[model samples]
Target: MESDLPIRKIIHVDMDAYYASVAQLDDPSLVGKPIAVGGGGTRGVISAASYEARTFGVRSAMSGALAKKLCPELIFVRTNFERYQELSEKIRAIFFEYTDLVEPLSLDEAYLDVTVNKKGNPSASMIAAEIREKIKARTGLNASAGISINKFIAKVASDINKPNGQKTVAPEDVLPFLETLDIKKFYGVGKVMKEKMYRHGIYTGADLKKKSVAFLQEHFGKSGAYYYDIVRGIHHSQVKPERTRKSLAAERTFSENISSEIFMLERLENIALEVERRLKKSKVAGRTITLKIKYRDFTLQTRSKTLPLYISSKELIMENVKDLLYQDEMRDSVRLLGISMSNLNNENPKKTKDISEKIIDVQLKLDF
Candidate 1:
């Protein structure tokens, strides 16, 4: 049976250790050495790690202390957001030269839909190569890309060849490629989920394919359906041009845990101020204010209150946050505090495609 779904060419371009790479590019002395961007202080968390540092198991989100233990000589560099934003714009400009269907996931990576591009390039793989070359020429940074028929496969393939490399999973190879993929390699399947899938006897995509949708849903809930479809190369998500901002937030991880309400209030004030500044800069207000608390033991808790009217000022945001904070007694010493605003006034409608409408079996012609 033939399906009516369109066979689109999607490319996922991800920079190689964006923050750490930028630091190395700016400083000649740091190249070829173990370097980590961010995670400077006692309680600091790593934002990015260079390939050199990664050799010693140093990774982003690892604590500064632990990273130091992993690689004693690892150089720690502070994050410079302004510099990162500047380079990100340069890369995105190059992406626009080929197609306007660019979706930036972060300052480091984005998804580009070039099924019908301005360059009239028939092969997405060729466009990806050109873009990587242009980025190297313009910014002196290496980028990796994954080209496939859908975003999920494209995203996963991008990591296959890392640090100045690219991979393209032609339409004909999608099913076989996924069948042999390790369950851990599936995008969105993290450590916890991987362990859960292991217990279910799903160690690979082929194992996942054997399970019935009803069995998957009964065990894994909503995400089970997603896993069932994706394992068979059946993702229908489109490459959105404009991803809406669902919420705005700011957070701080304290060097030392605090148990006193007075100290908590002090920390909340700073967080609220940052959130307000961000909200005002974006010209948006929110009716829901959520207080995120992370305890010393790493347990997380959230308290939220939604008002009838939208609020963007620091004073109003702090007012509701204080109420939520006092609404419950301290469970343990707090290690991190965050303020997030949701139900924003600037929410925009998103473009969506229904994967359930039909199954696509067209042979894609993406060449590598």
Candidate 2:
């Protein structure tokens, strides 16, 4: 099966400090300084940080309080997602000039199937270089690319030479490259999984490759086989052109915790409106409404209700959000409130059915 697999030309492109770079490019004064594109106050979390800020151990998703402590001089700017989205569209257009089989992971990264490109460019490496050049010319931002025979290696390779760099892992070198790779560098392995793998003596791809597929499956369930195949350079997932967004919602963290029911309801009204606006922008509705609340003590609670029909109106979303807010008594002062809608109405049935069938087939063979 390994020898029979067809080789493909895949490239993963990732922007360098996308949001922070955009901020710097727009404002000359922000360049070469430690900056983060999110609130940097108590109860706030960073959405993105500049490379300079990263030197001080600041990172996206780190608490704003912690980020401030890490880099005392860190500058905070409000997130400009609309500006980011505009640039993202420009980047995607540049990608389509090379290939139509482009799968976007987010606003900042995407995988392109350049095996058969519109430009008739046989070298994926050259294609990646030209793409990066075009992006810099058009948007004045740097991007990184990883070229390989599959999406897994390409995505991982892109991280090797980041911030206006590129790497190519040819078919013959894929196994050797993967074997020496730290298990933590594997696509699906998280911090917890890394620790678990270390405890199990699976520190590198070489160590992971030594285990039998059945042994891995026994220990890690379905993902075990997935890990086993990826380590052997056997990922077959294609680069899908249209990536459907699963959910859309908006939320906010208050500078001060509020305990008033009326105040909370008022906050939710605006949040619901924002969610509805986003839904309209995306031209999609959702069947499930989820309300998330975080208390001052940091404990989290979520309430979700799925409706029979999908909805995308501010009034309908507010109705649900208000109901959820009052569903349970306020246990403690709330610091954050959010509402998200899922089970979107615009899912691609062909993609969903293909994935479902593949899962069933794998499960049938595994007999677990």
Candidate 3:
């Protein structure tokens, strides 16, 4: 009764030294050299470091002063978030080609459920290999993958072969494989948790697995139940793609105060362009448009319009954005202008709309 959960096929895909790798990919001379991104000034921290820099004690979030002392010749560059985001989107699109059940951990790591995939391939390893290849082909970057019976093993496997490698754990090997896992490597067991585990003589997967769920809960509260289940390779969580996107809009602070209506229209034009660019890149469109304006005194006002159809076109977007801007009350010298869109069309209009309420309640249900 305890072993009835279906044999799951999960893959964890992680980019190797993601930020540093992207920098290296763009510059051939940087390859095989120690490089760090961020930390240009005296009081800055390193965002990421290449494998070469890591050998010299450089690490993410390390102070620039400390990192420089560790590696005299460490190369540092500013973080290019826009480029990083673009590459992330490109890589994510490749993953979608194989499976929609991708759960992105960050820009660099994600867990994928390949038990059921678009390619219909029974082999998760094959799908992983294809994804890795596509990423390299499209973006000129290397990525590592791990495949296993569940998310836990797959995540652990992905890091076993670092830089550019993969590992797989079959269902039958789960227990023995986890038996040898170090206490520190167990998910959710951090530095403090490690000390507690050591105190309890829980040094390995086998030690932790031996503790009753009730006993562990008594000792560790809510997390105890989690560790107990994972030690025995039990994780019932689904691959959730329920990611919520926050802040779908952007605004700007003007360099100068401008009063001309024509100038305001022109500023709104540029803002609209950026909004449309973001919408298309994210594969999203909105039914509403909003206009915000600020006067020289810093007082602000806004007006909005909701359309009957979802819009992504640049020209039409600006038209509605302009309308909203005009509708706003204007009294003083306008210093800043902004445009935004929301009220998304959750369903694609190209597809058939949902059945009418009467049809859904009567014909469809009754017919079935």
Worst 10 residues of 3 by lDDT: 359-368
Candidate order by lDDT, highest to lowest?
1, 2, 3
Ranking by TM-score: 2, 1, 3
Question: Model 2, stretches more than 4 Å misplaced?
Answer: 1-3, 348-368
Candidate 2 minimal-lDDT segment of 10 residues: 359-368
Regions of candidate 1 where Cα sits further than 4 Å from its true position? 1-4, 349-368
Summed over model 2, clashes come to 0
Error of 1 at 134 (Å): 1.9
Candidate 3 deviant stretches above 4 angstroms = 245-368
| Model 1 CA RMSD to the hidden true structure, in angstroms | 3.5
Count of backbone clashes, every candidate in sequence: 0, 0, 0
- The residue-by-residue lDDT of candidate 3 on 1-368, one tens digit each, is 13556666788999999999989988889999999998666656788999999999999979788999999999998778798999999999998887777789889889887776688687888888898989999999899998887788788889889888888777777888888999888767889999998998999998998899998999899999888888888877656665544325656555567788888778877888888888887788888887888788979887888889888777998888767767755788876677777876544335333221111122111000
What are the TM-scores, per candidate, against the unseen true structure?
0.89, 0.92, 0.68
Provide the global lDDT of candidate 2 against the true structure.
Answer: 0.89
Residue-level lDDT tens digits of model 1 in 272-359: 9989988997788999999999999999999999999999999999899999999999899999999999999867655455332222
Error of 1 at 111 (Å): 1.0
RMSD of each: 3.5, 5.6, 10.4
